[model samples]
Target: MGLQKYWRIVFVAVLLALAMIYREEAERIVNIVVSSPPWLFFACLFLVVAEFLLQALRMKLVFSKNWAEILRAYAVGLMVALSFPSRTLGEGARIAVMAKELKVKKEEMAAYVSVERVADVVVLATAASLVLLEVHPFLLAAAVLGICTFLAVIESDTVYRKVSRGPVPELLRKYIEESRKIVKDRALFAAILGISVVLWGIDFLRMWVVVHTMGGTIDYTAVASLVSLAYIVSALSFLPGGLGVYEGGLAGGLVLKGVPHDVAVAATLYERLFSYWLWILVGAAAGAFKRENGSSSTA
Candidate 1:
């Protein structure tokens, strides 16, 4: 195996070692999972499936494509994102699928996908800000959104001219210009953000239902930020599916927010079980069906 693959394996091994360290808690976590309500589990699973559809629609709104094709592309990306440690594979898959399926220009696809991620962060942080109620965090989120907008709004030709004397690459120039064009589309920009809010809102509510089913209750508004922050923490370490790390961060965060530690852990694990591991399983099934059906003519 290549050194990179070896490193990822080592990270997985580290994750395993950490799980062993918490072996007893892990056992209890397992029991809790085994006993979770079957109906509730299915409901949460349905929510996850719906969330995927909504997410694909969000992407399509910003970059026009047949919805089925875009969804297949996202499923392919999700499969790799779940199976690997690196975060970029899914993005790389997204670009490749769009190029292959939608004939989207690579640079243009990159520009819009990058913007979509920034917009996702903005929208989630806004949801987080909703319950946080702290002016400083809201201001910080606003600053982040402002910077992303600035990048998207900057005149690429002017930027290139200013740095033309430098060693900037042609590809970077194209990407920047594409981003500028995408963000300048006021209608598309508004549509993307609007879709984003709804997307993240549903995502947070999915978690709320899971927690509620587990006999834990939380402030309705806090669900958005809690869910957002938990996910943000999971992605931060670049571990595929966040594995053991998400449990700690999520449970700890919930404990700080007044949930009993045991309840917090149970809720986190249940939600992750559905949203992470089961998500990968569902993606694989969907991908198989897509392949068997061939690309939809509509796609």
Candidate 2:
């Protein structure tokens, strides 16, 4: 746990360094965002908050017996989004913390978090497939296949257990058990999936608003596909909320659709300023509240 704290400190320090070096670029981006109509800007903010609310509701559904545990789970989810890949361990830590607070076994929490993450992948793949014809068809097909495999493994108790028992070592028995639990919790998993999709949709809308503010000629499909692809990349970036990587990916996608490179860069930066940083502040506040209140998990 101490090591994890040290890693987080290092990650924050690195983010500060990067932000300082790119201060001019970041400021330039903010200027464009400020120039946009206030209503449009506020709309984007509303969507972000809505995303969080939906997630909170989903968490409640997932841990139906434990209202307090739901908050802790949702808080961890927010923390995961705020820090992203940089706090890779934070996801697992959140699960561990929930288990500790709820007096549940660690394996149970692990099962839940694992289901949450896998559901994210399944949800994204499904959504991407509906609009698959718009982007790289091959990649979309691959995503579909991956989603199918993931569902097959984690959503089936008999098959998962059979696979776990065959060839795999006895060391992985706990993993099999947890995966079975994930399968058993279908209703909660679906709820989380719905919330995850809605969250991503809100984020796409926010990006679209930023693009419009920059006077881009892009349409909804263009905006959604590009933003979705960027998210897929950034989610795996392992950087602090994918800071530099996300901005670059968004800019690149916009430029590919014929938007001016500089404008794309500026818009991406502005969206992050309002969205990412704002969420970080909210996550920080929630974390502080959790600590101060000595909250116990009810899972």
Which 10 successive residues of model 1 have the least lDDT summed?
1-10
Clashing pairs in 2: 69-298
Write down the TM-score of every candidate. 0.79, 0.76
For candidate 2, write residues 195-299 as lDDT tens digits: 777777787788887787788878866777777667667766666666656778879979888887667977887787666677656656766777777654532
lDDT of each: 0.70, 0.68
The most accurate candidate by lDDT is 1
Pairs of residues at least 3 apart in sequence or in different chains that clash in candidate 1: none
Give lDDT: candidate 1, residue 119: 73
- True-vs-predicted CA distance for residue 256, candidate 2, Å: 1.3
lDDT of 1 at 154: 58
